[model samples]
Target: MKLNMVLDNKKTILVLALVLLSFIGIGSLLPEELTLQRWVAAFFAANALVAMALTFVLSTRLEILETIFRGLDRVYKAHRWAGMWSVFSIFMHWWLVPQSETPRDESSLMEIGSDTGEWATWLLLALVVISFMRILPYHLWRWSHRLMGLVFFVSVFHYLFAVRPFQLFSPAGIAMNVTAIVGLAAWWYYAFGKSTSKHHLAKVQNVKKENGVVSFEAKPLQGRPTWNAGQFAFISVLHHEKIAKEPHPFTIASSQHQGVARFSVAGLGDYTKTLYDHLSNGDMVRLDMPYGRFKLNRSSSPQIWMGSGIGITPFVAWLQELNYTGALTSKSCPNVVLYYLVKNAEAAIFAEELQQLTENLPSVTLKIVYSEEGRITPERIADDLNGNVDNAELYFCGNPEVRKAMQEGLESLGMPKNNTHYELFDFRGAI
Candidate 1:
């Protein structure tokens, strides 16, 4: 199996296991005088800090922000596991370090039981509970989620004031604290403060249902940035301000026109269902700036765009973008093949537009797969590949399971790793 395949399957579990092994190794090597538990406690504290950051990034649904935040997720995930191990290490440290031997200036067990520690422990426990039990009511979980920042803050202070080595004398400890503070502030700004209504809202000029998907014609409010095809924006209707702020990322369904942008949203989640029910033409709503790195323009090779369900939204935008720029007319665009998989014929929104686009652009080809009608097995894809699969650049936007399966299957057919690209839609973590 490919490395990406392994990462797709065991990313979280692998991180946790590695952190556990590292903690064990460090604890065994440490001298009796310097217990490993204290070090572990400090490690947990750092991990918690990063986890809090991950929560913020996940909440925003900003694709550009997520691109950066994914790196942070890796760090936070490792930190989380390490931090849990550290908690055990710290417990051991407290157990091993005799009361009489503890420095007089160091915080006593009584201090650990004080108001600050009590609040910190409660908040941390809440975070742990919510992270594990995501099925908890969304609103209730959201209300408790805000407490993570406070927990992180208290934990940092607790580390500095309650721990002895982290005093002004320890440069490494001081640096870690400072880094944590800066990271927390930066994440907070990106998640909340930096976002503005001016760049976020788009006026819905029109709504049309071609097949089953509803496409909204939107013009960003003054000062909002323009977007390219294959890019997506987070959108929320105005009435639910809080939920609106929690934007759901959707691909711009319409091609970029002179003054307006378009987004095609399938009624999937609660927010989307509400949008379909209540939203109307001429309504104004908030939309986060467009963000995503997937673009056909960037590559010179023949392209294979694979979309599942509403995931076809980006390719629609890609075709529109090319058409608007006259690339399609000039025949300058590279050969493109769109493999759109939907549940049924009714779900194939923009089917007419897709057919028209392929007709206009001689280089473009269209393929539709209906899973409800018939299964699309790996052998089928291989049989269909013939000799063309080797050089085709593949891109996917859909659920993780489907994406992983498609990726693995395509790789097995000799497609290179570099040629495959996929987008992550659903956000995870505290936010």
Candidate 2:
């Protein structure tokens, strides 16, 4: 991986560091004569506690976390990893720590804590397994996943009242308490506050279906949520009370200056297919706005943009923003070339609009690439750049496999990896 990609995962590194520090802090309070298995098991328990707390924190969708993690998408990615690590840590802690057979001088609270831990272990394991099973229906999986907050609550109770080595005021103890409270608070906000406070009601308008995509404009019933170009939002249609209230993420296809949000949905999955069939004009929808960091960077270097399939939505927004701001007239504006990659001309969404936008904006050059004829490889990009690839910055939003291929190919052709930025569309690990 490139240095930039490594830096993108800095949040995960920070979490791992916390795990180490916590383990050491707790170890300081342990008896010196304790066996290696006992110490390791204790460390794993601490690890699980820390990871679990953070997993909850990441799900809250707090603005500060978005800034720290670079984007909400990255935050969700970290959330997924943290949850996985928590389960793994729990298993290690369970296996390595032997159960006591004889009755001891344990208090009622400690005994209750031990029982809670055992029950939480099975529940956590089952939920984690269910999350990974894509075969399960999405509605069923989502409903099942909501019970995780309860599991974390139980786990924290176990951590608190259990017979532990560290004192409440000590480093490990303080960390656990702080994290537990923060995690629970975050979970509360996600479970309750998100639907009530974060989402805004919008009336759907100008619904159009063309080329297997449904495009619609959503006018907010109240104040509009401000968003930059190339960001995405989660929206759920208010259908006949039977449809799942779960919102699906889609890229905003209109400039923020438009004052009304727009989305182009392609029927790729079951929920989306249902949405395509049911969504109509004047329907009330709930929108959770403005999530993503796929905006254009402040660089004077020539730019190359590639959008494949539905990924073209973000680039369309960028173009609309440029037109709105009159940035195309500026002499200092960087030269831009956008390649719309599709299987064929029929697959290209907003083809006429994109061409007109490029024509109006002198700084931008548009190229429509059909996969039926040719591939948009690094060599082809270099040719388009007139072999001036050294100083050009590349931006791509599309299929993950295509992004990986282009990244490797570009690096091999002497292009700086840091010059390339992309949005990872897959949020399967996240709720």
Candidate 3:
């Protein structure tokens, strides 16, 4: 499945190639230690360095970078994998080929650098574990995760100080330093740059609570940021409740030209529940606007959209935008069948709005899949679409577990893996 995804995404393929080549190039510059174990250690260290560096490359938010990955979702996926790979490589480097014992006459600076490197490895290992273990409280995971910058800084210092004189000036050292610098820059931008730039000053115009969700109607304070149908933004409300200062990515649930964008906040975590408690119509909010690649207009293929619970937000945006974007009657608009799975009719929050939106569009159909009657299955989706699954594009915005099951089931029923697209709303993915 991973191989198929990489093959399907040309950008991922290029990134994978570049990382491998860099490792090889860096390894070539290192002097032969004449010992096999030492060579293995050098290889793993080079890999660890390159992997962490690539993690920085994946984490940054640049238009060209997003296009290369096809979306921020893919970039996060790549970042998570690269980070884990680095940790794994570090483990191998530590255990299989132990670091050489320091000389008794080693300088104090060298000793401190060595100690810092050791500490950094431990810190990185803990941080990576917390990132993947979503069971940890988000507040705990978030703040603990930021310590990774310190790790990168220390690791670079260690490399520069602890390595042999010959290697200190080698291509490997230069390459590693370049990567470390990039990683630091990425961290700095993530910590300070992004919030200050691309921020759309906005104020809450209204807030509505419905079916365990709080929907906000926010009016942009300055010129409203131009947006496409399926993008998301990191929203930070000023004078907010606990965890609200930390931005959360929310899909724009209304049309961009509507003068106000809607974000339906589900009470899934501390930030969200607190958002419901404290968010008011006149509250000030900041938006880092227009992110993600879960777009629909480019494809004219018969499209299948799947949404469950709050995952319906992006689809709502698309449905709302279609009328004004000319997609309502465009020849390029594919035949669309949206499946919004929920527990029951009562949980189908947008049932009324969706009905109204689709009333005018003959090409679009909305199906409410109430699991109370029966859970949606691959066979059901195939039959629902009249077996036109072949070559049709499937877009899903929902939880990763459900998306995995759906993808697997669809693939078993003869749907191409590459035919499906999804946006993981997992905000932990933001950086």
Ranking of all predicted structures according to TM-score, beginning with the best and ending with the worst: 2, 3, 1
**Candidate 1: 10-residue stretch with minimal lDDT:** 65-74
Which residue segments of model 3 deviate by more than 4 Å? 1-8, 96-103, 134-136, 165-167, 241-243, 298-300, 327-331, 427-431
What digit string (tens of lDDT, one per residue) describes model 1 on residues 345-430?
Answer: 77776577788877766667788888888866555665655556676667778766887887787778877775667656533441
Best by lDDT: 2
TM-score of 1: 0.76
- Give the 10-residue window scoring lowest on summed lDDT in candidate 2: 325-334
Candidate 2 vs candidate 3: the TM-score winner is: 2
> Which pairs clash in the backbone of model 1?
37-89, 37-90, 40-86, 44-83, 200-287
Against the true structure, candidate 3 reaches a TM-score of 0.89
Candidate 1 wrongly placed segments (more than 4 Å): 1-115, 137-140, 190-192, 209-212, 240-245, 297-300, 328-331, 378-385, 429-431
Residue lDDT tens for model 3, 16-60: 898778767866877665377777776776677777777776666
For candidate 2, write residues 199-269 as lDDT tens digits.
78999999988777888999999986888999888888776464567777899998988888999988888
Model 2, runs deviating above 4 Å: 1-35, 104-109, 167-171, 195-197, 241-243, 327-332
